[model samples]
Target: MAIPTPGQPVRGSRSGAPIMALFDLLGRRWGMGILWHLSQGPCSFRELQQRCETISPTILNRRLKELREALFIERCDKGYCLTPLGSDLQKLLVPLGAFSRTWAEVLPHEEASS
Candidate 1:
């Protein structure tokens, strides 16, 4: 799949609003997980795979390529690290993380349907 671009149609928006495009990219499997982990520090492919426990190598490679193309991450000698833009995004998400914790506390837990 091609990386979601601002002007091109994304998953939910036909007009492809920038925010929608961002959501489309980050909503993919392991997309947000990769960025969140990389925010901690640089990690090589093997290290990142370990951090993201269940992510298959194929999906990790694809997400890395897409993130790099989007200027959110870059490969350095150390390994894959977040770019300034990605760091900025991570900062923005911090508050959302806090809110999620609180929200989780309030929400009723769902039992498994089985």
Candidate 2:
């Protein structure tokens, strides 16, 4: 799928609202994970693959390309790193991360419930 662009059709939104487009991109498999990992520091392709242990090279390459096109990441001498816009987005997600941890603590595990 092409990178979700604002004003273009995206999942769930015919108008492709900016936020919906963002959600479409980040909601993709391993998309948010890649960004989260890169928030720590830059990583080479191999290193990123190692970080996302189950991600196929093809998918990783695709995600990297998509992220680059979105201007959320850039290829630098060191490796792939978050762009300024990406950093801002990451900061915004920090609260969501905290909320998820708290929610996880309260939610019953499926295995245990079973």
- Judging by lDDT against the true structure, name the best candidate: 1
TM-score between candidate 1 and the true structure:
0.91
> What is the clash count for each candidate, in the order shown?
0, 0
User: What is the Å distance of residue 114 in model 2 from its true position?
Assistant: 11
How well does candidate 2 match the true structure in TM-score terms? 0.91
- Residue runs of model 2 more than 4 Å from their true location after superposition: 110-114
Instruction: In model 1, state the lDDT of residue 38.
Output: 91
Candidate 2 global lDDT: 0.91
For each candidate in the order shown, give its overall lDDT on alpha carbons: 0.92, 0.91
Residue-by-residue lDDT tens digits, candidate 1, 1-114: 889999999988999999999999999999888988998899899999999999999999999999999999999988899999999988887888899999998999777968
Best by TM-score: 2
